[model samples]
Target chain A: MIWVNTIVQGILLGGLYALFAAGLSLVFGIMRLVNLAHGDLIVLGAYLILLLVTLLGLSPFVAVLVAAPAMFALGWALQRYMLNRVLGDDILPPLLVTFGLSIVLQNALLEGFSADSQRLPTAGLASASIELGAINVGVLPLMTLVTAVLVIVVLNQIFYRTRLGRAFRATSDDAVTASLMGIKPANIFAVATGIAMIIVTIAALYLGTRANFDPSVGPARLIYAFEAVIIGGLGSLWGTLLGGIIIGLAQTLGAAINPEWQILSGHIAFLLVLLVRPRGLFPRAVD
Target chain B: MTLINASSHRVEIATSASRLAAIAGFVIVVLLFAAPAFVSRRLLQDLFFILTMLGLAQCWNLLAGYGGLVSIGQQAFVGIGAYALFGTSILLGVNPVPAILIGGVVAALLAIPTAFFAFRLAGAYFAIGTWVIAEIVRLLVAQWKMLGGGTGTSLPNSIRREFWFTETIQDLFGVRAAASRDILAYWLALILVLSVIGGIYWLLRSRRGLALSAVRDNLQAARSVGVDALRMRWFVFISAAFGTGMIGALIYMQKARISPDAAFSVQDWTAYVIFIVVIGGIGTIEGPIIGVLVFFILQALLADFGSWYLMILGVIGIAVMLFAPRGLWGLFSDRTGIQLFPIRRRLVRPMISNDKREG
Candidate 1:
């Protein structure tokens, strides 16, 4: 019974990992850019949400509504003015640029927030848990998992159902041909990054509410998010979710065995998965 | 026998500027080597920092700039190398000098498994995969109780007594054991910088260097032309790890302390190295040499500003990537065409060439 409870808790935790990775996956799917700053951007989003909640006295949930659009604009501008300039034949520029951005974001956060850890005040929602037969689950983790699913579902709808989705697909397939067909790859990339940032905002809401965060935590989250992306395989959204679950399960199970092994277990699980499926469990693109 | 006579045509690999620069570089290195005699211990420590960082930057430039590996997790080698030195010295009672070499071997061995996993991903994903490996190594190393686990441990006082040159330097220099130790470390760092620079320059001028740049520019093209891409990548990756590990061990040995956090710090080992390479210029031997000096000066000037200094460096790195993608040395080279270490071969037609007579 206790083991079952741990498994359930692990699956719930996977939801948060998936949330952290969804934005990264989407950006990469469209632009083939692995933003080294994605984790820092998420941290930036959390701080933004924290700011709005504190300054406006709004509920944490409502603060995201205000922060999301702002984050979208920031992402859109970032892609248009910076990332697009460096996105050609050589892979070094974009990688280095994003890496520099990551350092800038992390240090800026430290300058602004200091080295102190901060958390979103969640009223009693953080401590609230519900029972399911022999197992119990935290409300925050449950909500996080549900929100992750919803975000993926909505992102899928935008990718397949909307005209914008067609533009995104066309541009991703071949930028020159897509541009010849009246689709602007730069604008599409900017829009895609904007949408990714909105997802980041949603992920930030949960991240801030569930745990304490400091400037230095972003890089660790980046490693986890990156692991989830790789385990899920490149360009596969659903695979990312499963990847997250695998990592989360590894961490929880490892912790169950020994507290010190929690993070190490997740990394080992990632390596194991790589050994078995080098292309990820659900590879979407042939490339 | 041939349409173009051998004596009439020459392949030139060095320019007048490069020849002059080579002589100047020798003089600079000689001065640096003798600095401990005239300089204060404080100055020696600072020079040690610059030399060690220059060595690491040179290694990274070889991997990323020449080989196109673009790894962001080089701290794995650095941390593992440091830990190996500490572990062997503390546990096996090995002398710290030889232990530094063992650290290099361990780091090179670790690279085999790391490459196995990281090579599965292409380009940007490869960068992230390496970072994951580094994190895994850091977490595991933290569990070693003999190394003081998470809190970390310092080298024993006996290490100072046991260090190869400490007493020799103490007697010769008439300084304290600690100052003599610093002087010895500074000399090691100077030697490391010279060897790393010389080794890289030699490699870049060799046949393998040509293959490396070819691989960097286009993997498929290089393979199509009969270049063994996998072998090249593996060779460069392992060599880089070995050099980086040795430097890591040397650094920690100088500090005389080892914590998983300090040993494995991504910011100190990887980020700073990356920044140095980017701002210096990725593909050239001269870039890192220039970049390290600039970095040292900037660091010294901004040491008091804390995070703001890092922010400024980050911004500078981004700006360089955007506007002058080849880095400061690249920009200067483009304008002046003055290569201090020329690798590009120019074909020169002699005044008595058959071509002139034929035309």
Candidate 2:
């Protein structure tokens, strides 16, 4: 019974990890960019939400709504102006540039927020939990899981059913050809990054509410997100969820056995998966 | 038909400017070696810091610049090396000096498994994969109770005071115990920087260096020419790991304290090294040398500002990446065509003989 409870909780935690990875997968699928500042950007989103909540005296959910559009614009401008210029044959420039951006964001946040860990002021949802027979699960984790599913579903619909999605696909397939076809690859990239930022804001809502976070936490989040993307196979959104679940399960199980092994177990699981499947469990056929 | 071959054939490795630079460099090194005799203890410590960082920057440049592997997880090797030094000395009672060497060897050995896993990913994935591996190593190290787990451990005082050169430095230079240790560590750092620079320069001049450049430029073309691209990359990666390990071990030995977090700090070891390389020049040997100087200057100027210092560095790094990807030294080298350490093979023939033959 205890083991079952741990597994169930792990699955729920996986949902948050999936949310963390969704934006990363979306951007990578379109632009082939592995933003080193990605984790920092998520932290940035959380801060934006925190700011909205603190200043406007808004609820956490309402603050996310306010933060999302603002984050979208920031991502769009960042992509169009800074990141877009660095994307090319050489991989080092984008990687190094984003690394610098990560440092900038981290330190700027540190200066602004004073390195003190902050949590979004939740009324009571953060502490609320539900009983399901033998297992009791936190309401926030359940909502996060549900939101993660909805996000992935909506993302898939966008990829398959929307015009902009086609442009994203077209641009990703071959930017030169897409540009000749009047797609404006740069604009498509900006839009993609903007959408990814919106997803990041959603993830932030949960992250800020669920745990205390400071500026330096970005890289650790990035590691988890990167691991999810890799395990799920690059360019596959649904795969990211499964990858996240696997990691979440590993962590909880490891913690059950020995609490100190929780984080290490996730990494060990990642390494094991990498060893077995070098291209990830479900690598995109085209890539 | 008997061909009258009168043209003298020679391949010049260095230009006249480079020769002069080499002579000047030798003089500067000699003066630096004599610095403990006259310089302030604080200044020596700073120079020691600069030299170790320079060594790290050079090794990273060799991997990312020439080998085409942009790794952000080099802290894995650094941490592992430091930990290995502490473990061997503490557990096995090995002498601290030899333990440093053992740390390097262990790091190199560890790189084999690391490269095995990291090599599976291409480009940016590979970078993150190495980072995850580093995190794993850190977490695992933190579990070892003997090493103080996550809290970390310090070198024994007996080992610190009784190390090989402590007495020799005190006897030779007549400095105090702590100052003598600093001078000894400083000398080691100096030796490390010189060897790494010299070694990388020599490697870049070899036939393998040609292949490395070829692979970096175009991997497909290199493979088409039977260059064995993967082999070249593996060689460079392993060699870099070895050199980086030695430097990491030496760094912690000087500190005499080893903590998992401090040992595996990406900000201190990897990020700053990357900044130095990108702002100096990624693919050139001279870039890190210039980059380290700029970094030292910035550190000296901005050390008082706390987080603002790092923010400024980040902003400068981004701006430099955007505006000048080749770095400050690269810009200068482009305009003046002066290579302080020239390695490009130049074919030369006696001008008169060649002209006569052509005529």
> Quick one: best lDDT, which candidate?
1
Per-model TM-score on C-alpha atoms: 0.98, 0.98
Candidate 1, residues B195-272: lDDT per residue as tens digits?
A: 888888888899998999899999999999999999999999999999999999999999989899989889999999
lDDT of 2 at B180: 94
lDDT of 1 at B344: 94
True contacts kept of 2: 0.90
Which runs in model 1 stand beyond 4 Å of their true positions? Answer: B1-7, B353-359
Worst 10 residues of 2 chain B by lDDT: B1-10
Model 2: per-residue Cα lDDT over B108-221, one tens digit each:
998899999999999988899889988999899999899999999999898888777789899999889999989989998899889999999999999999999999999999
Model 2 misplacement above 4 A: B1-9, B353-359
Query: Model 2 in CAPRI terms: which quality?
Result: high
